[model samples]
Target: MKNTSQSETISIIGAGLVGSLLAVLLAKRGYQVEVYERRPDMRKNTISAGRSINLALANRGIYPLQQAGLMEKVTPILTAMKGRMVHDLEGKQNFQSYGQKVEEVIYSVSRGQLNKICMDAAEETGLVNIHFNQKCESVNFIDKTMTLTDELSNESRQVTFEHIIGTDGSTSAVRDAIHQVNSSQHDIIPLGHSYKELRIPPGKNGEFLIDKNALHIWPRGGYMLIALPNEDASFTVTLFMPNQGEISFENFDTPEKVKDFFKRYFSNVVPLIPDLSQDFFNNPTGKLATIKCSPWHYQDKALILGDAAHAVVPFHGQGMNCGFEDALNLVETIDKYPNDWQTIFSEVEKNRKINGDAIADMAIENYITMRDSVRDEKFLLRNALAFELENRFPDYFCPRYSMVMFHRLPYAEAKSRGSIQEEILMQLTDSARALDDINYSIAEKLIKQKLSRVQLNPN
Candidate 1:
């Protein structure tokens, strides 16, 4: 742990996952920390109203949990998903391993549950203070004051702080405040895709009907249905689709239309959803967005992290993972510059923006890969070859999915490495297909060269 100057007082807004985890990390380092959340303590509450997709905690997210020493407490609460179980139109299932080994598993945990664990951990630190139902309305950086309103009482209060950190969500009030103060550079671009959550209840015997070790998917060309395992032996399913103008609820309103749509498109999982029509009609559709901003910090007194800084789509299953990583990175930066808050803020802004933009692009590209490319014959063939390559060269040629989801490689670096691996696989496949003149020795030499290059320069 790194010690910071005693003069610095850090106030974090929003007790969501990133904010709460960051509060713990900062407090552990002997900093005076306060966290403000707009809603009540989630442990006492039921389902959060509009949370669409639950979290799929991969290596990046798990590493932070371990660092915070909360992984031991939360690991038992998650269900492991080792691979993807793809469903075909005829109800046949195809298994695709996420990594070479089954131990490289992604955990399926509820967003609310994970947040509660982080909040409880932060509270236990005793060096941190948590304020619930306190919604930050504005920030006065000049005066170093934050004005917050009580959601229930409709009363307002002001508090003074040396520095403020905004982990407030995508539609963050602190972000809005930053925009008001610094207008020219910030922008939040909303992706046109909207998503909705549905459920697949457990069987009568209280057992999983589908394989619990795998994440289930029903890819429908333009749209897709995905399900993650739950501790209760049920599954939380989500559907991603275009909003009102493209495939609006109006056209999908009636039970007959909904039934026809599901039966034609996602027949394998349609029957599992008991209230298919009602769920489709009643559930609120969530809009996806990617937020881009220059200079995430507002001078030495304040900075933003988490969704407030970068909000990517869920296709890559990395929104929360990236946010958790943000907290870890921010703490490290602060540790590196214990005396100079200005330098820490500047460095975080510079590095985080690059990583954020890289992930946003990868997330969008993954949407296409998830919803469309899964059905392509060539893509499937290439995936098979990649798996075989991984088996043959266990330490060297890992699939890009394994690197991104099962390893701690940065998204930008993963994209670059994955692109090179793809090209090598294409060349190898082309050579192998030309069996009239077999070139096994040349292909093996080429693969070894590529592996050596990756080992030398893994960035």
Candidate 2:
């Protein structure tokens, strides 16, 4: 690692979660950082409703907070979710533990609150300056200049920088500029699904209306409704369904239709959210997409990170965590190759692109698993067997979900091993209906033959 230096000034675009955290990390390295965000300062202004998704902070994300020395402040706002609480139409509930150990849990965090905390941390660094409502109109890589337009006044200003990093988001001006110069391929693949954010307010006397420790999911094969707990004893609930299907957001146009739809599907949840119809009609429906692009940097003059570079769907709840990982990796790479911006940017993209793509694919796959497969007894059986295998073969086998959530294993590595584990599970559970009926001898043999011993140091 290189020693901190104050000579370099880094201009970062966007003051969202990743950008704010990146500002803190860069400032800690003694770099003079300036951040420009298109949105108004959320702390001073009320955030726009319905667009915010509850973030699932896992080990990958928490490590960066720890590295930035902000975990102490972040912990209080986090609500630990140990498992998925699947609610059936009949109101029967099934809890699926995420992992074996107590520490193997993900956190439910409000995006707005977390972003505010990160911004506060960045400002506390004193070396970072964040300018809000300043939208980047364009970037001139040739001259190392960026044009920022004041959102309020529609006035534009030219800014010069030593180095520029864009955490702007999916629709990024920096990314558009980079693509103009470098002939790179990019695609925004829509999931054909949209989501509406609703709220489950607290009970009387500020009491939690439901279980506060688990992420609640009402899965209907073609669509799903998920709720994450908040510190205020309320829950941030999201409903994801197709945009124009027989049973979709398009189908429920009126308040009566919305109430009837909820009563038909998420019947148990209708009572918890008193103004369900109002929330459904009032909250805007947000689109879901996976944004992919290559050559994320432009000759070291500029680079983009987080959602600007790779935006995945939120099914796996790794969007924020993955972006945080990108920030962490970029800063670490800079430390490793100080003064070599080309190498730093190249290494950052090389290290993250494949992993980002892997997680993207996995996120889509998880959407199906969450919405459809969770109802399968076979899926539950495999999940249980995965835990047993990890316990039995400790070093050789770890479930893919566990590896992704709890361990520092590369996302690509986890996906690969998960495929092998899935095959093993299928073979082992071929004839068996439950864990008791499964033959241990075949499982041990298959695991030993298929998986190599791994050193897992989970966070």
Which number leads on TM-score?
2
Ten residues in sequence with the least summed lDDT for candidate 2: 46-55
In model 1, the Cα lDDT at residue 174 comes to 77
- Local accuracy of candidate 2 as per-residue lDDT tens digits, 199-242: 99999999998899998999999999999999999998999999
In order, the Cα lDDT scores of the candidates are 0.81, 0.90
Residue 337 lDDT in candidate 1: 86
TM-score of each model, in listed order: 0.93, 0.98
Model 2, position 57, has a per-residue lDDT of 95
TM match of model 2 to true structure: 0.98
Q: Which regions of candidate 1 are displaced past 4 Å?
A: 47-50, 244-250, 391-396, 430-459
- lDDT: worst 10-residue window of model 1: 450-459
